[model samples]
Target chain A: MVPVFLAQWMKEKRSPYMVLIFISISIAAALLFGSNMDIKLKIDTFRGEGVTVEEAERWIDRLNESGAFIFSLRAEEESLADVRQGRSDMAVRLLKDDYRIIAVMESTNVELVQQHMQAVYHEEFRIMAAASHAEDELEFREAMKTYMEQPPLKLQSSTSSGSELRSYDMRLQLLFGFSLFLAMLTVGFRVNAMTAEKISGIWNRVILSPLTKTEMYLGHLTYSTLIGIVQITMVFLLAKYLFGFSLGHSFGMLAMIVVLYTMTIVAMSMLFTGILRTPEQFGAIFTSIVPIMPLISGAYMPPGTITNDVLLFIGQFLPLQHALDALIGVSIYEQGWTDIYLPLAKLLLMAVIFFGVGINLVERRRL
Target chain B: MLETVELSKSFKGKTVVDGVSLYLDQGESVGLLGPNGAGKSTTISMISSLLAPTHGDVLLRGKSVIKHPQDIRRVLGVVPQEIALYEELSAYENLQFFGRIYKLKKTALESKIQEVLEIVGLRERQKELIKTFSGGMKRRINIAAALLHNPQIVIMDEPTVGIDPQSRNHILDTVRYLNLEKGTTVLYTSHYMEEVEQLCKRMYIMDHGKVIASGTKEELGRILSSEDTILLQLDAYDDAFIEEIRSLDPVRQVERTDQGLKLIIAKQSRVLSSIVQSAERHSVQLINMHVHTPSLEDVFLHLTGRTLRD
Candidate 1:
């Protein structure tokens, strides 16, 4: 089977268009994993009239720990000029002895620096009350606990990873998805071609040759699968290297998933062959099914976002979706085999179903 | 030797090939001649093991190929009516593809590709894509691909359709060469009567999905020996004139050709005077006239009362 597939691959060779797509995908994948951002700590002294002294001190400490720290001055006596003149990374002005946390990081670092300050302040307060006076500490702890318990009025931090479940940018994945779709397309068309050859005049030429149906089927089937695999591999490697796309799964696992997905594609192609009479008819059939398949199977979006119950169920049935979900699961959650079993199982089952249908469609009939 | 025993096929409850029983001895060339939609293609499909006959069996070398068509398929070659060569690939690539499918050994397959390319007179153009080739060139390459596997029995289904006269003659010569020189059994199917008349020693005439007639051309010629054809040309004529001519006593059958009128007369007819008398009575300006022996076209006309095209 390997030799047959390889032989067919060498015979067809890759078209130039395919080579271009591969090169592009590799560049794109490399871009995803290479973006970087920097952050620093600081403090501010322009406290609003509503601020209290302890709140100001706590804010200042948080800045000292997580933000770029400059200098502090007493509100009544210390000169702001001395603090500003090369004394610190940032200058703080004490207003009524209350402070505000501020930072002068590059715009890219500002948000990250602010996020760290807030987290650090919250932690420091808990520690400070734990070490200070007992009865006062108890009272202070209760008050501080209540204050800490109060959710911030506007707690918007884009850098807070917990705020958003990070999803890999799907455009890159969709490219690979399209490759799988193309594989299925190839299979569908090839089936019609084979059927036409079988019934028309060419079957005699085919059969009289030493070629067996299995060999012919495999030869074409291998070409289709390899086309898909090559496209997928090219896209996958690009997404992996260019995008910094933590593919989150082992290379071997991803390869296995691609193989299963391609097998299912072959099966679907066979089904089309069995049902359609001509290449044009197969194209029509393929168009009718393929567009809907990507939509239902969550090829472009998360499965949970797909609204239709039937479509969702069907998506779960599609090996491509299952494989993608399993890949994402491994990548995002750092899941291992135990967590992957269900999607893997579903993929295998779908593969079997597809193969069975394809065999039934393609096997020579009695009459 | 290969043979089909009472092989029949029906589609959608209509029989297409009904009770076709024929055999070919090794190296013997047989032709299947039929009018359009005459089950010739369908029969060859079954005989090639591509389609299963609804009933009966195909026997190759005394073994039933119906249940095990694969065994028969191995030594049988088919050239279909439609051009089946891939337009995207070069001639050599296409042949190489077919070669790989046939499971030729790697070295032998390469050599066979080179050999078939030479035989088809396209070795220099082997690298040129088939889509770029002329219709005749593609046809030759199509035949060459079939020849690559060196099958014992070669089946060509209307192989010369729409080809230039030169290419058609070339294909005919190559087929004859393969059969006579290489000792390969040939099954040729064509709607063209002349191709069959010139090439096939044995012929089968199919109609409405059944073998209505089968024999040597001489044997089939005997079927219409009782009647002979006479063609009459006129510089001027009218329907009334043809009507009067059809009423002539010696005319067994009458039909109009483009330039003149045709008649089938009894074999013993000596009706030149009667024909001239009818022409004179009708005031038809007679230009030319001829009497000729019956042909396969006449035989088909006698059998179905229609032209082979119909």
Candidate 2:
């Protein structure tokens, strides 16, 4: 049975398809990283000449104390893409009197940069007034100060788009969810294939043999988990080596969680097969369910952003949410076993429930 | 020995197999004969424990298999009507997988796989993937996969349904070898009467979920002893010729077909010559003729008023 599974996996390898998925992820990551780099360079240049690190640090400290980091400028009005492309950190207005503070990033991490901009604001404005009386320096400064003081209730920040935590560890939540997805498909497809054989008559050969249902189920689950572990470990290696992601949380603990999660998925698949009699039905159900998973999983999108009350409610019952939460703790916070015990316990509890429900459903078919 | 006592099953409110009783002793061969929708597969499924009988019981070695299915399932091999081998795996790989399932240890399992592959005459092509195999090869491997464990009682459900004559003959020879040479009890099912007549010693005729008749080949054939079969090939067949053939001496009934006419006669030899004589008188050319003694197909036609193929 074990060899059969290995042979089966070898037959399904289709290495080229996997390579395509990997290439797509790499390309997406590179594009996002490049865009971030271009924005970083533009902000640096806007800080202007000979702004010493010490002066920047002092200015940043003041801005941090004041809890404000504002950017205001004026240029020929054009597309939002152009405003962003020139790598301007905020929206810029080139009014006759003064520029408007359309965007602000609260000084949380880079306070010194905010301070350097504030220090040179008045000097830059005065130099512009000397060249042309098209703008009043005092009035322009006052307008800019008022704008910064009020700073429109909502502020858009560049840091918000990326992983907000500087540590690579926090992204483990995404990796964990991805691992769960892999486990779901692997185990589910195997179970689907096996059940299809049962319905289509191949199982008769095995049924009359010494192999009991327990052995068949165990053999498949064991092989599926092994495959899942390999896939997950590869994703982690890629993250660590190629993408610089963290995985310092106890590998043992993560393995334990992953095993439970894999079992849960396997059990869920069994339940699905029991409910849906044919492979076509299974395919339909799997497709319908897979797209909705990432939302509950908080893999590509966080559960917090999901405003639909029903989806949020459903998210709590979903295995992905608990697994993702545990992942965030273990990877992001570098949490110890003590910190993760609660979420891990919940996951195990849910796993038990799913297993019970699934087994009951499948076994009931015997009647 | 394998037996089903009053075995019954229903699906979605329709009784698919009702009150079917059958028994096969050691080394005995039985064929199940029935038209389509006659519940042959359903009965086999119940005996194999692949299905739960709505009522009654199936037994192996005097122990009720429904109560202890694993005991029977361990020794009973079934070749389904459909090809059941995995197309993704090669013939050898499929046999090994099933061999392991039957808990054959490494050394013995290897020897047994070689043995079965040789028996099936596919030893040289064992490594070829099933998906790449021809239809006949696939059918042969399908049967070979079922024989890996050397089962005591083997049930083949319409195994020769859609195979070339050569493969069909190979399968029939294998069945004969398994039953006669190896003392394996066999339960075979098919709609084809000739295969059943060629292979089965005892047989059962089923229709609409009921076993209408069961006996030895001769005994079942004897059920319609009063009526013998006559075949007549003619240049053309018409209602008048059919009526004239029925009115002939010893002719009990007549059925006309495009090729010729079938006359069920009380005395087949007495009427066969007269039918040819009458065909010439009616300006009908007698192309060929035969007197078919009462066989399973006659018994099926007698019981159902429809041929097995119908």
lDDT of 2 by residue, A286-316 (tens): 8689657766655654335567877778877
Residues B1-310, model 2: lDDT tens digits: 8889999998889999999999998889999999889999999989998788999999888898988889887777788888887777788888887787777899999999999888778999998888898777787788887887888888998888877889888889889999999988999999999998889998999999999999988888788888878677778756777778777767766666557876677853566666767777778888988777866676777688788988
Clashes of each: 23, 5
Give the local distance difference test score of model 2. Answer: 0.70
C-alpha root-mean-square deviation, candidate 2: 8.2
What's the true lDDT of residue B140 in model 2? Answer: 79
Per-residue alpha-carbon lDDT of model 1 for A255-326, expressed as tens digits? 877777777776677767766666667778777887677667766553466788888777776666776776
Model 1, B190-228: lDDT tens per residue? 888888888889988888877788899999999978888
Clashes of 2: 5
Which candidate number has the best DockQ?
2
Give the TM-score of chain A in candidate 2.
Answer: 0.63
